[model samples]
Target: MNLNGTAALVTGAGRRIGRVIALALAERGADIIVHCYQSRADAEETAGQVNRLGRRAMVLSADQRDWNAVESLCRQAWDTFGGIEVLVNSAAVYRRTPLGDIAESDWDEMLDTDLKGPFAFARFLGPRMKERGCGKIISISDTAARMIWPGYIPYCVAKAGVDAMTRGLARALAPEVQVNAIAAGTVLWPDGFDAHQQEQALGHVPLRRAGSPADIARAVCFLVEHGDYITGAVLPVDGGRHLEG
Candidate 1:
């Protein structure tokens, strides 16, 4: 993957880690398709940053939980950019649902957005990339999938599914499209976390520090550019937190 002048689509790219990934790709000279569900203003801002980097950019909105919307997103990206050479499935939702209070809707939302959404994107765009005989797909997974998280069963399960999807898609689309994942840990503290909670979270990491979005972005860049022989790998960008257990 040369990355230069390639077309890349990053879901949930309106903000947070996704935004960083989109900007990093654009910095490497890839045209960006910034996908968002509700953060249109943020998505537009990301597109502006990409353009300022001297790369082409387009903002597209789609509900990843909707199969039809996912399909439509692929179609629109292809229609606008001819074809996407890189697909980064970064869209996801996280919620703290304790076991006793878990609802059916909570499970559905978690699995649909975090797991099925990436699967749908890969399912639809994979064959086309296969026909072209070269492409890259990276899913954003989580370290929680590899460890037990008391109040986030649904999120953990969904990310585990993403790990499985990455391996399965790698084999299914092998010899052409490479599929991989980034299992991150404590990269960005979510809103509502108090200083004490944040400290407790960081305490588990062997590095004794939190990771930045740029850390994940750099891993994405490596997979997109230098990882020619790498596929089906779930690289951990967790600052050694996964090593704790």
Candidate 2:
């Protein structure tokens, strides 16, 4: 993909999908600023992996829901890396907040973390990229945003807003920075699920299997490394489950 001189900022890079994407971008030759909130150990592990890929890596901690934190995160990333060439908004708060039982705090937190954080980061990063004349900003979305997930209503709504924000930024940042998203299906089984529960869930996937963090990581790399013409696109890495779901 020839990202030899580029720098990338990845949020929630402490573990899981975010960790994998951080490593993938490093492998593709982009220096990385990996962001994490509470998982300092895991964030260090991710940075170690990025360094192993022979790309420069730095770890930054910030709660994505906080505006000051989001602004500072981008500032620190730009300062550490000289500049950011890509921004991946992968930090998110996910939980089953059913419509009926969704508390004010729960709703606010989900919206702020999953939606507002990305918007704020993009707002800060977009102008800088405009000065450089080229950049990419990718956000992570969930299948729940496409189809109603009864108990996960709040998370779904927040992700939907993320989708809308991605498109808006694509238009606003046109001719310079590209904005896009990757909507995932039953990728990693959520933590605490038993083997039987995992199997039951896979039955619904057309591929008869769950995806790995690498699958999602690969999509991000494709967007950042190869999809220059593709803006405002929400590519689904959902194993065709979006069809049935």
Candidate 3:
């Protein structure tokens, strides 16, 4: 996919890694649609950055829990940009749902945002892109899915589902739209991680260091802009974290 002049919708692009991915795509000449739920202000800031890079930008807000949100987002993106050639599922929820005390709401939030939400976007846009001839869909998964954490069972499960869905979508959208995922490592510490926990987590990685948001962003760029022959693959951008086990 030629990112030049292409339109991409990056969900959860309000801040953090999502913001970085949005900027990276814009810098490469792709216009961005910054999606956010509570971070509308941050998303607007991201859109401004994209415009300063000489690429067009738009801000769209939607709750990932709702099924209608994806349809609305795709419809507006098509109307505004004529068509979106790329889709990035960067929005996610990472909550600690330990066993024995897990609530149903916790499971709902994690699966809805991390798994179902991204799947909805791809399912809605995959065929559209295939019809248009070519497209790319990239989701931000996590290494924890492979090495599940005791305290984040729901998060790990949702991310695992993302990997599974990535493979499924790849075959479903084959011949034109490429569907893939980036299983991120310890790029940024989750909100509640203590220093000790962070250190313990990094110890498993051979590199023994945390990766930056740009690391994942670059992987996203490679998948969308340079990965013509790649699909259904979950590329790990985790400082060798996944390789440890």
Candidate 4:
């Protein structure tokens, strides 16, 4: 689908990859609905950038894990732009939940924020897109879902859930809207990742380096602007890390 003049909803657009994706879509001539959980200031900044790019932009905040909040978020998105032609589920939390230190709350937060949150948005928005007869849904998944990185069991599980949800939604949304995932690997290292940890992470990457957010951003553009025949697929923008194992 052509991105020109359409509207895109990008979750977690306050910072990081989500921010990059938002700007990229704006550059493609799409207005942006920036969603943030607690980063309104940053989201506003992102919206300003979009405006500067000559595209309409707005900031909305919501708790992705809350059904009511998600429902309201969707309402505002449509009401503001008439309709959202693209939905990018980029809001997620990543944390280390080691085997022994893992707690119930850890599981809840990871699953709720990382897995259920994205699903809730897609579940609430996918049908509407289907009704419109055209749309694109892309979730930012992780290669860790395939590798099952140690010390991050919950994160891995949540990303695995994202992969599953992507496929399921693609089928559910059918020929109208394309649903897919981009499984990233080591694009942005988390805080507190020591040099040793970073080294270990890159050791598994055949490209021997981490990726930049632009890589993922470009892939998103391709799926949104050029992937008319693609759906239910997880495209890896991991610099070949997913191929290591």
Task: Indicate which candidate wins on TM-score.
Answer: 1
Model 3, residue pairs in steric clash: none
C-alpha lDDT (0 to 100) for residue 28 of candidate 1: 92
In lDDT terms, how accurate is model 2?
0.89
lDDT per residue for candidate 4 within 42-104, as digits (tens), equals 999999999999999989999998989998989988998999999999999988788999999
Which residue pairs show collisions in model 1?
none
Q: What is the lDDT of residue 228 in candidate 3?
A: 93
Tens-place lDDT digits, model 1, residues 1-245: 89887999999999999999999999998999999999999999999999999999999999999999999988999889999999999999997999999999999999999999999889999989999989999998999999859899999999999999999999999989999999998988888999999999998999999999999999999999998899999999999889987
Which 10 successive residues of model 2 have the least lDDT summed?
93-102
**Per-model tally of clashing residue pairs:** 0, 0, 0, 0
**lDDT of every predicted structure (CA atoms):** 0.94, 0.89, 0.92, 0.93
Residue 117 local lDDT, model 1? 94
Q: Which of 1 and 2 is the better model by lDDT?
A: 1
lDDT winner among the candidates? 1
Question: What is the TM-score (0 to 1) of candidate 1?
Answer: 0.99
lDDT digits (tens) for residues 1-245 of candidate 3? 77998999999999999999999999999999999999989999999999999999999999987879878987898789989899999999887787989999999999998999998888788889999999999999998889888889999999999999999999989989899999999888878889999989889999989999999999999999899999999999898988887
The 10 consecutive residues of candidate 4 with the worst lDDT sum are 89-98
lDDT of 2 by residue, 123-191 (tens): 999989978898999999987788868888778989999889989999999989999999998777677
List where candidate 3 sits over 4 angstroms from the true fold.
none
